[model samples]
Target: MIAITEGPINTQAVIDAVQADGAGAINVFIGTVRNQTQAKPVIQLDFEAYDSMAVKKMQEIANQAAERWPIQKVAIVHRKGTLQIGEAAVVIAVSTPHRKASFEACEYIIDTLKQVVPIWKKEKFEDGDVWVAAHP
Candidate 1:
């Protein structure tokens, strides 16, 4: 499953999507909105994405991880629109026969998604807002 939604991300659903009978390990990574950036208090965050391209890039990242590891299944769900502090912005889950592969693949998917996915994040500070990198 690869999706770009404007609502809250269901982290458990992402994990469940990757469950496999032969897989012994499932790794999940959740990216959350923080209350501050560089000591500046943040009121909220607004995320925007070229939805179709974002989903395509995410799927490509998943496929690449599958090539590098013995990944049984993978799910990546990212939320756009406004989000408050502590809300999950993204959830990535991967399952593999072994723990190491699951860990590696999960990490790879998130790292690559940040680099390649066409998602923009705007940090809404108390005084102003500034656009930042997707996962910065």
Candidate 2:
């Protein structure tokens, strides 16, 4: 499952969607908005995305993870629009029969998503705002 939402991500829902009977472990990654960046105070963040392309890219990442690891299910949910500090912007859940694969795949999904997904983040600072790169 993959989605780009305008509201806050539902962590519980994402976890429930990726849970399975055969899965022994589920690794979840939550990306939250930070209060500061580059030594500047950030008030909030505005996320924008090419919705259709972002979801497609997320699914591709999930498929790649499934192929490389023994994963049972994957759910990636990313939030758009304005988000305050500490608010969850993205949630990724991956389930597998063992802990290692679940952990690895979950990390892979988030890293790959940031690299490939067509989602842009604008950092709102007290002085000005700028569109920041999705990945460092």
Candidate that scores best on TM-score: 2
- Candidate 2, residues 2-101, lDDT tens digits: the string is 9999988889999999889999999999999999987899999999999999999999999999999999999999999999999999999999999999
Model 2 RMSD to the real structure? 0.8
The local distance difference test score of model 2 is 0.95
Looking at model 1, the pairs that clash are none
Residue pairs with colliding backbones in model 2 are none
lDDT winner: 2
Q: Give the lDDT of residue 34 in candidate 2.
A: 94
- Which segments of model 2 are wrong by more than 4 Å? none
* Candidate 1 per-residue C-alpha lDDT over 23-91 given as tens digits, one digit per residue, 9 for 90 to 100: 999999999999998898999999999999999999899999999999999999999999999999999
